[model samples]
Target: MMRTPAPRLRTYLSGYVLSLVLTVAAYLLVTHPSYSTSLIVGLISALAVVQFLVQLVFFLHISAERKPRWKLMVFIFMVGIVLIIVVGSIWIMNNLNYRMTPQQINTYLNNQGGGF
Candidate 1:
């Protein structure tokens, strides 16, 4: 019978350190606010993707799979689902924001006898 080898402590530790570094980096970026909002957000997003890869490789050991083809397909499907959900949520929120002008808000509030 073929047995899979157990993950070494070094792998876990590396994943932990990388996760910690990414978290701290993101925190520092937000707290310092040295860059433009869009740039900072883009950097954070990139960091998040890197952090996800670190977790998958070091912790999940996805790269160690004997049959990686199916795993890759599943991962792609999961990513697609996540993207759809995120994009749909953003689209809904943007549409809501577009519909709710400041003037319309004030008029609605006045009609409702002010301040909810």
Candidate 2:
């Protein structure tokens, strides 16, 4: 399909620059060690989501103009699955923490040869 190299290179460079900016922002937040852990985690997560969207649009070439929107549909499905897994894992861990007493945790740890 007689595509020009200049346009493709431009798209790639734009995506690369955006990705680099997001990565550096995340890195600064992590290495500074001034912010609280929760704040740093939240910032990093937001950066990750922005980077994901940039990759989807630029590198993957996903858009309404493209034929067969199934790629976008599949991506949505995969994202849903990932969100389910992460939410489920956090929910399970919270429930376990609530149900297990400190004494029980210590005893279980000792039983597993991780005694202090």
Candidate 3:
């Protein structure tokens, strides 16, 4: 049986430091609130993507694969599933909001003889 080489300590340390920095930066951005809401959200999202990449490379060691490509394929499939869930949730919420306005809710409740 072939033994795989262990990852160096520096990789983990770097990942930890980068993750910490990104978390602190995101916290500071939210707490300080110097920029516009959209800009802040965009910045924090960018930082989150960077942090994810750092975790993938340093912690998950996805780039260090030797033979099988299944891990990478699985990761991609997981991301797709997550995207589908998120988008579907958002779409469902938006549709519900559009369909159930305040007036509509009152009418619905009144029809059921339980309205305010």
Candidate 4:
């Protein structure tokens, strides 16, 4: 009986190492910047997306042969939806809080005062 050769372990190891490096780099970018919060946040977000793609293609081996493509696709779609929802909620809430009319502000403050 012929034995099949084992898959290359080094490839997987390298991919893991790359992913770790990217994660650390992203973290550093987010934490080290003291003034440019917006720039840091954008860089971190971009890095996260790149790291996720790397993990999916290299670590997870998400390919046609996997046959569970739909599962991965669905997960990605759900993540996208959640991200949009969260970001949109934050933006809308911020706008509403800061841009409210005097009447709206008075009503909100009154409600809070009543609770207190």
Top model number, TM-score: 3
* Candidate 4 residue runs with Cα over 4 Å from true position: 1-8, 30-35, 64-68, 101-104, 108-116
Where model 1 places Cα greater than 4 Å from the true spot, the runs are: 1-4, 99-116
For model 4 the local lDDT of residue 46 reads 87
List model 3 lDDT by residue over 1-116, tens digit each.
32335789999999999999999999999999999999999999999999999999999888877667678899999999999999999999999998898998999999999887
* Tens digit per residue, CA lDDT, model 2, 1-116: 42222237778889999999999999988988788999899989999999998987778767523555677788889989998999999999999999999999899999999955
Candidate 2 versus the native: TM-score? 0.76
lDDT (Cα, tens digit) per residue for candidate 1, span 34-115: 9999999999999999999999999987777665357768988999999999999999999999999888888999999995
Q: List the lowest-lDDT window of 10 residues for candidate 3.
A: 1-10
Candidate 2 stretches greater than 4 Å from native: 1-7, 102-116
Q: Of 1 and 3, which scores higher on TM-score?
A: 3
Candidate 1 or 3, higher lDDT?
3
The TM-score values for the models, in the order shown, are 0.73, 0.76, 0.83, 0.64
lDDT at position 60, candidate 2: 74
Tell me, by lDDT, which candidate is best: 3
Which has the better TM-score: candidate 2, or candidate 3? 3
Worst 10 residues of 2 by lDDT: 1-10
Error of 4 at 60 (Å): 2.0
